[model samples]
Target: MPETNTARLVHRLATLRERLQPEMDRREFLRTLVTGGYALGMAQLLGVEDFLAADDGEVPIVTARVRENPDDPFSLVEQTRDVPAEWYAAVQNAFELNERLARIAYTGYLGSAVVPGDYASGTASISIGVSNEGQSAREMIRDVSEGISINTETIIEIEEIEDGFEYAEPRYVESVDDGRVPSGIACETPSSLATLSPALYHPDEEEAFFVTAEHAFKDEPDPVGHPLALPLDRVERLELGTVVYAHPGEDFVAVEPNGEMRPVSRIAAPSPVRVRGQYTRLGLADLVARGEELEKVGALTGHTTGRIQGVDAVTCFTDEFCRRGQIRWGGEMDLTDGDSGSVSYHSDPDGRDDDVLVAGFNNARTWWPGQSYVWGVSAYKLTAEHGYHF
Candidate 1:
């Protein structure tokens, strides 16, 4: 019986090698033999050990979760996470394929996102948004896909979100009973009402500035000179500052404080939620694998909690220019017209009452027929682009 079992194992190994032979490099094929018995990704997929590691192959996957500096957006201090290597490889593969698809975005390619699998499940997939025109581009798409599972959404056309409601002009708030104005409160732009966010730290200037979504000022040709303020009512408004800089691509704006009012590290929750710090790209991936949910406060929605659907997503569906490194979570309904500029957060597992780490900024929700979820730029992307942190 033992001899028979050994023979069966040999047969399975031969079969796996034969199937992977055409695709794998000779060096990789040889290195895979170090696993001895399990097929590629099988051991790690089963939560036994890392299949990718040749030596002993029981390596633990660790990633950073919490940061040391809660106030500094650029702070790199983080909590370590032990993840399943198979899950990590799968999610990493999804991110690579998502990038490749974006690089050669043909006329019909609408957009794509990276969907990560739960821990121990060892699965990852990419969802692509495409138009009917892109079907003819299949061969090239397939070449780029490299056998990765790609789900495509065919749309004839796409449109920007439009609601004709106009906001009351110059509405003001004299004061909040609380001294610090948390995020998810009504803030004033020249033409519309938008949500307020926590302080945005710019490393170059070493300054903490008030922040919100850039699209809130989309109606204005240039938002640079626009005033940002707090609205108590139509008659009593508090001024925050003017738009120092606007990043239309990322969908966020930095406001310089002009009055005594300032941006704080607090979020508007029934319980006090203080900003701990932001997550790195891997940190967000770890959050998804652990089946964790994120919470956010919006001007209209108040407070809501939702799962992280995908990470490192590329959204081409929103504007003419594609937005990369987006986080998709919750249903589109979780966000409303006045919800833009709110920050999505996750509670610190370390149990700090006020400490909640931010996931991303909520800019726009779903508009495509099939897609659902609020999408926005991650804090990591903001740091990568402009040396700014939330």
Candidate 2:
């Protein structure tokens, strides 16, 4: 009976070895064991840490890391037509000239005002650029003086001055006179200046001479509103994803999978905001002059999107911290104090490509609920203006 039992056991062991031979190959077995051990270690190090701190064994559910939404058609309208290379060059030169002229005119005026303590007395001239088509140029100059008050009664006034082209000859006539009891009597001297004729004073110039092609080209009428479609393929081409970090007071400290750290700005965005509308609508008309320059550059990458929740209120270190003139998308993407500098991105259908543009950077979030006010620095603007690329 014992001999028969031993024979049966031997037969069963041989059958089991034959059945498990494929899985027990030395190389395969080693690979499996290593992989399993690595996975287990990672779970214990990362996943287990997050899970153990919870009140219950049940893991807390966080919002999904990505979202897909239908593209809006109104956001896709191309605002400008492609101009001939030569014409485009001229347009660019003209735009530059206009900007230079504006700076020169304003700075000259301010410099004059600065003499004699006028600046100290809060008496300074402010100059703003206005295009001929009744559109204001992008550059604005604000001069605030802290000393010297203006004596309007003693000052001479000039009206209807037509300053000619910056390159043209000057046509201004100026004469200074002291205030005294004398009507047209050159008592202290003719203390006044005026334009003699339309030669070249300070008249508003109207022409398309220096208009940036981007600004000159009007939006074509599109009944279908195709511009709003999210360019999914382009987004994918950029390989965009958000960089998550922890907020340390007013600043952001980078958090790595290994718990390593670094410091960053305290901007926050709980949800990705879709940017639509033309460059003009976004207040980027000025930067559009350099659009061609931007075309040669690369877009930002590694940006991802995730939903931020449980935010009651958010505050910035300074009132003007995120109040710059950047387009903001209003929605219920909650981000709290320690969540600043978190990147928000929309999912792209095409994956990563070269043509996709990085629209904005996380900047700030409004505290109020039902009013998801999130602000970001327009990446488009930075690219167009400063040739910035990330």
**lDDT score for residue 2 of model 2:** 57
For residues 35-87, could you state the per-residue lDDT of candidate 2 as single tens digits? 43334354443334433343331232221111122132122323332222222
Least well predicted 10-residue stretch by lDDT in candidate 2: 180-189
Return the TM-score for each candidate structure: 0.79, 0.21
lDDT of 1 by residue, 74-160 (tens): 665546455554566667667888898898878888777888777777778787778888888777767777656777768654675
- Give the number of the best model, judged by lDDT: 1
Candidate 1 has its poorest 10 consecutive residues by lDDT at: 50-59
Per-model clash counts, in order, read 12, 38
